[model samples]
Target chain A: MLYLVGLGLHDEKDVTVRGMEAIKGSERVYLEAYTSILGVGKERLDAFYGKDIVVADRDMVEMDSDEILRDADKVDVAFLVVGDPFGATTHADLLLRADALSIPYTVIHNASVMNAVGALGLALYNYGQTVSIPFFTDSWRPDSWLERVRENMRLGLHTLCLLDIKVKEQSEENLARGRKIYEPPRYMSVPTAISQLLSLLEDSSPSASSDSSPSLASADSLDPSTTLAISASRVGAPSQRFVAGTLAELSELDEEAFGGPLHSFVIVGRRFHALERDFAGRWAVDRERWNEVSNTVYAVRD
Target chain B: MLYLVGLGLHDEKDVTVRGMEAIKGSERVYLEAYTSILGVGKERLDAFYGKDIVVADRDMVEMDSDEILRDADKVDVAFLVVGDPFGATTHADLLLRADALSIPYTVIHNASVMNAVGALGLALYNYGQTVSIPFFTDSWRPDSWLERVRENMRLGLHTLCLLDIKVKEQSEENLARGRKIYEPPRYMSVPTAISQLLSLLEDSSPSASSDSSPSLASADSLDPSTTLAISASRVGAPSQRFVAGTLAELSELDEEAFGGPLHSFVIVGRRFHALERDFAGRWAVDRERWNEVSNTVYAVRD
Candidate 1:
């Protein structure tokens, strides 16, 4: 039997009881560690679960999945993933492979950012498609994610923007030389993402840059000086920090306020409900500034 | 301190270790009922936690929240919710109230359908705005949800249609008369939802019934004979079942195939990736028939 278990979020203790039972019942446990990271290391998990965990990187899971599924037909093998198992598409491929190999599997679900983002006080039902903002290099900058955020805003729906996390990535020279060298891990910070967004907005606004008319009308809806947003750092972690303010204010926010990796941003939509505003206001770095932006820009008079 | 803990989908064992710790530390534990239900009853959770569980229905949560928040500043009060604490907006209200009362609070996240739906092999990032389909009555049949479906389809994104569940609902007469009479719970089955969708499609088709033209251009995108769907019953449960087929075939699916309550439906979008198609095809009730429709309608001719 193949058991796909979720190690919710944060440290090792966040794993669900069912997931723990599955791990204890299994003969071998493999943890997928490339896509996301837990606050604590495998040793902490080993100490907590009282089981030896083999850390499986991207190459092992994507290339040699058969080893992970070895003898699953005869014995219980547990595959652990940070966050929910289905948060990434690679796990689905693993599940499909298990099905093809006639291995019976059980999925134990746990918390992921997809659902945990609801902590921002916005109704999940009111959220449109979520977008992922990748780190921009000198020559590579993608605006498709911005288009998605614009579409959500045009529909009066909030957009959950997932910042990128580059783990175990290789440099161009190392890749060309077929070397095993890896670059340092990079996690897109909320301030960095805001700066990218502001640059894009400025480039698109006719008054800011060259008067090349924008292709998307929705791009004009967001003015960095007026649009409100919520920047969340290390969501679902014990040391979570949230700041609510205008996009400009968020870009200039104190870098030390939000610490660590796995940051996310939410572009508040036009249909911001009063209750949502009230709830989010509690986390504002400056309540007066948040109200000033929200009142004129997001106030629902009804 | 007020602790909002999530009891993940299915049985009592689905609760996270952090949630278990909170329950153990709490002086009083209240389970929010009415929005969604756990597979096991309060007795099962009580037995697992070895603590008394107070069930908080809609009235107690919406009207008597102050009482629930009373003395939270001095005590550890655990407000348990099925799925993630923020899956429903009411819990956010409770958290806001906690803040108003100067009560420190912590949120223990768990899996909810928002993320669990990824088990169907569709990438969570590719899914657009989710829609809720309510039980249609003679006078209260609103098709606004169809607009959401159309918007997602237009964007070539999958739409997760949440079937409505009526729990402890009071009729107009009962409410107006100040009586506490409750209606029997009604969980929307997949077949019932399909029947409603088919009826709506037929009614809107120009060739069906009257000769009036359809108001929505996107209505043409969904054809009962060609559009594929996934009928999921009891998601996240041990006995969960998934059947994939065309809408026409799904409408005629056997009732016995999907037993019990809490069903959901997913309308496969036009931009079905090859991997998604292959994975979803594994669950097809009739592989040949599914292939016939999928190839002619959703074929990604790469």
Candidate 2:
């Protein structure tokens, strides 16, 4: 049997109880590393899971998935994922391979970013289209995500903007020369995403499809000074924090003590329930208005 | 402090290790029973969690939130939710309430059906609008969700059709008599959902806009079959199963065995991914023939 277990977003503890049992019961366990990540390191995961795990990088997974599944035909092998197994397409490939080989496989689900965005108090249902804001570059920067964001804003829905994370990615020279040179891994911050979004929205003004432009098409709509929430969640851990504020305010909301790798950002779009608006309020526009807005946003009947 | 933790989709083992810790540490732990439910009963959940838990129904959460938050100011309190904390807006209301009352709060994230759909090998980036299909009565059959599905299908984007679950809902008679009588909950299955979708599609043929739809017309090209995959995922535990079939074949597959509540359906209106298609090959289809069709509809590979 091949087991795909989700470790969730934070530290070792983020693994579901069943996921832990699966890990302990597996003949061999592999933790796929490239797709998503836990806030805590491997050592912490190892201690909490009570088992040693081989960290599988891109090469190990894409090239060596067969090796991982080879023994599944014999006994159980559970592969750990930082979030739910199907959270990314790579794991789905692993499942497809297992199916093709006629290996009995089971998936152990855990929390992933899809539902975790609820921490920001946006109704998951009200979220229109989710878009990814890739790391910007002088040459490869793309403005496609802007159009999706506009669609959500036009319909008064929220957009969960997943920031880009480049992990253990090899540079062109390294791959060509067969050397070990690599670019440093980077996780996109909310402020950086907001800035990129601003540039993209501004870009849409000149030669865009006239009919598709947002009614709230001004530069202010993309401004970081506008209200938004940034959740620097250490999901698998106990100290997970979801701080809300205007994009500019959260950028200044104390550089986060979230304490490890694997961070994503949520940029709030318009339209919400009074209750949802309340959750968004807790992040506070500024320290000065923190108490008042916090009350107004959260002051549902309770 | 008040902590809201998502218990994921299936059983007790679905709760994240972080969520378990919060429950273990809390002076009071309550399971919110209205929005969604775990696959098992409270006793099963308690046995798996190693603690006795109080089930908090909608009345307890919506009407008695102050009582719950009031205690949080003095001692730790943990409120459990199905899926992720914010998957339902009620938890958001609780979080904002906790924030307003100066009760420090933390949200532990989990995987809900939102991202788990990726498990079916659909590109998350390509899903457009998400619509919910609510249960209908003879007098009040609603077709609004059909419109949203059509719109999303037109855009060549996939639509995540969230099946409705009516929990602790009152009966029409109960409402009329001012009684608090409750009705049994209903969770729409994929078979049931597809029944509705096919009926709507065939019935709305004349009035339905597929070719001129924004999602469909704007796409460079799209395949009707390759464009969609319907999934019935019983996520959460190791025994979870996902069946990937076309909307047509789904109604004929084994539905009861998909097992448990919190099931969701996807209407693959339009969307394609190179890797997603590659991964989708092994799921409930003939590989030799699927490959021939896959080549035609897949996104251009990187």
Candidate 3:
């Protein structure tokens, strides 16, 4: 049997009880590393599981999936994922291949950001098309993500904006040279994302730059500063931290002392359910933070 | 302190390790009974936790939220929810109320359909505006959901069509009579959802219904019966069972054989990674299962 387990959004212990059992029962355990990583390192999970793990990066999972599934018919094999096994499509592929090979398999689910975003207090039902805002460079920035966000906001729906993470990414030169070298891993911060969002909105719509605008970009529905709530959550951990604030304030905000890799952002949309607004207010305690948040516009409400 | 914890997708054991701790630590543990239900009854969770759980319906959480948080200032309290803590907007309201009352709050995350739709083998990043497909009525059926699906297919993005559940829903007649009775809960099945999708597609594009015209649904992108998969997953449980097949096959599927209630369906979109396709293929042995997936026209085709 081949088991695909979701380790959830935080550390090693985030694995479901069932997932842990599957790992313990499996003859081979592999942690797919590239698509997503646990907030804590693999060693932590290894320590918890009391087993040596084979870390499968993109190349191994994508390029060598068949080899990974070998002999699954002979004994139990477990493939561990950072979040729910299905949170990422790569595992689904592995499952499909297992099926093709007629290998029996089961999936163990776990907490992931899709539902975890509620930490900032947004309704999952009210959330619309989720978009990823990738880190942009001088030459290759994409704005289609903005269009999607605009569409989501137009419907009074909340948007969960996933920031880009470049892991083991090869620079163009390195790729062309066929070098094995990789660029440093980059996890986009809520603040950096906000700065880019502001610039892009300003560049797309001239009116957005006006002084009278209530800190909302061109697609303002609520004052962006007042509506945005960010959580620097290292979820699935005992010490997981979640601090909310507007995007503008979040940009200037610095306190994720939550150790290492993987952080995403949420762009709070308009249409408060009373509770959403209330949950968001919890993060705006300090006067300086309040001032920072006050500078954003949610939608360009007429 | 008030903690809103998601019990996760299926049952009592679905509760995360953190959520379990919160339940054990809370002075009051209230399970919101309206938005959704776990696979098991409150008694089961109570037995597992060795504590009594108060079931909070709409009245208590909304009209009398102050009562729930009243003691939070002086005690640790938890509002338990099925799925992720903020999976529903109602919890957000509860959190907001707590914040207003000066109660510190926290959210514990868990797996939910929002992320679990990958069960059908679509890339999470490739899914476009998710829309709920409500069970149609004799008079109130709306095809509006088709637009979102079409838009997603256009962009080659998968559409995670969240099947609507009517829990604690008021009936028009009951409301008119000032009665407080709720209609029975409903969970949509794949065959039914497919029927709705086919009807709406044919209705909107009548010209495409020529005798020999492709089934209005194409299999060029994926083999529906082979690629399409259905999961009657009683997730977060020991006996969870998931099956994949053509809408026609799964529609006729006996989920009782799979396990129990709270089943969801995924309408596969065109854009899929090679791995995703392979993984989704594992769920079903039929090609038509995969053929059911359509490419949304509005997505960025990335």
Candidate 4:
């Protein structure tokens, strides 16, 4: 049997009781570490579970999954993910491999950023299609995700932007040279994401006609100063921080404002419910601006 | 301090270790019972947590919220939600109330149907705005939610339809007579939701021009026979079941196929990914039909 357990966001204690039971009963445990990371370290989890966990990097889970599933039909093997198992496609692919091997698997669901973002007081139902913001490089800057945000804004729906995390990544020099050197992990901060978004908006502006795609025609609809957004860091953790402000304001914030990694941003929709506004307003960078925008720009429903 | 802890879907064991600790340390534990429920009963939770839980119904949480927060400032008070605390707007309201009273609070996140639906293999990022399907009555048959579904389909995004759950509801007669008599709880099953959707589609068809509203002008784009959908019951529970099929076929399915309450429905959009198709294909009621629709109607991507 195979057990795909979820280590809910934050520390080792975030794991469900059922998940803990699965870990305790497993013959061997593997912790998937590439897609996302828990707030605690492997040492803490090892001490809590009383089991030595084999850290499975992206290569081990993606390229050599057969090793992870070996003998699963006979003995219980637990594969732990930082969030819900289905949060990333790679984990789903691992499950598919398990299916192909005829290994019976049980998934113990726990909270992921998808649902944990609700801690910011935005109704999950009001969110539109979630988009990912990748770390923009000077040579490989991509603004394709802007269309998703634009579509969400057009439909009066909030967009949850998941910032990129590069873990155990090989640098360009190492990849070409085949040298096994890995760069230090980098987590996209809220300020970086906001700056990237602002840059994309500027590039897609009508003034930059030479370098704009037709798909980004609707980018003009978004106004950085007037649009409300909420930047959350380390959601579901004890140190979780949320700041609601305009994109421009958030872009100007220092890294110290929202410490740590695993930050997420939400672009508020035009159709903001009164309750949602009230709940989020408590965390606003400027209460006066939040109130003014709520009354003038946003269409607050009863 | 007030602790809003989420008991993830399924039994008492679904609660996180941190949530359990909060419950154990709290002077008073109140279970938010009206919004949703777990697979196990209160007795099971009592046995597991070794604490008597006070079930907070709609009235207690809404009208009598002050009582729940009366002494919360002085001692640890835990308010348990079946899913994530922010899954519903009512919980957000409670948090706002806490903020208004200057009560310090912490939210322990857990999996809700919003993210748990990913167990069906569909990526959470592909899902659009969620809609709720209420049980249709002779006089109050609402098709307003269809527009949201249509918008999702139009954007090539899947729609997660949360089936309505009526708990501790009073009948009109009982309300008129000023009685406390409550009607039996009714949970909207997948088949019932499908039938309601089908009826709405029929009503909004071009042939029924006399009765349809102008807002439903794009209703013609939806074809029940070709549209793919997945019906899930008791998701995140051990007995959870998922069936993928056309709306018409699922509507004819027996109740026995998906047992119990807390059912959810998903309408697959035209932009179905190959991976999503493969994962959902495992539960297809008609494999041949599912394949044909995938090839002919759905624009599947790699």
| Whole-model lDDT per candidate | 0.83, 0.68, 0.67, 0.86
* Model 1 chain A weakest lDDT span, ten residues long: A211-220
Model 4, C-alpha of B1: deviation from truth (Å): 1.0
lDDT of candidate 2 over A9-90, digit per residue (tens): 7778778777888888888889998877776678987787677889999899988989899879889898988777766544
Query: Which residue pairs show backbone clashes in model 1?
Result: none
The model with the greatest TM-score is 4
- TM-score result, candidate 1: 0.94
DockQ of each: 0.72, 0.54, 0.44, 0.68
User: Between prediction 1 and prediction 3, which has the larger TM-score?
Assistant: 1
Two-chain DockQ for model 4 = 0.68
**Can you write out model 1's per-residue Cα lDDT over B114-158, one digit (the tens) per residue?**
889888887888777788899998888778888788777777778
- Which wins on lDDT, candidate 1 or candidate 2? 1
* TM values, all candidates: 0.94, 0.84, 0.79, 0.95
Q: Pick the candidate with the highest lDDT.
A: 4
Query: What tens-digit string does per-residue lDDT give for candidate 4 at A1-302?
Result: 89989899999999999999999999999999988999989999999999999999989988999999999999999999998888855366888889999999998989999888888777788889999999998798888888988888888889999999999999999999999999999999999998888888777675642434323434335667777899989999989999998787788889999899989999998768788788888889998888777666674655
Arrange candidates, best DockQ first.
1, 4, 2, 3
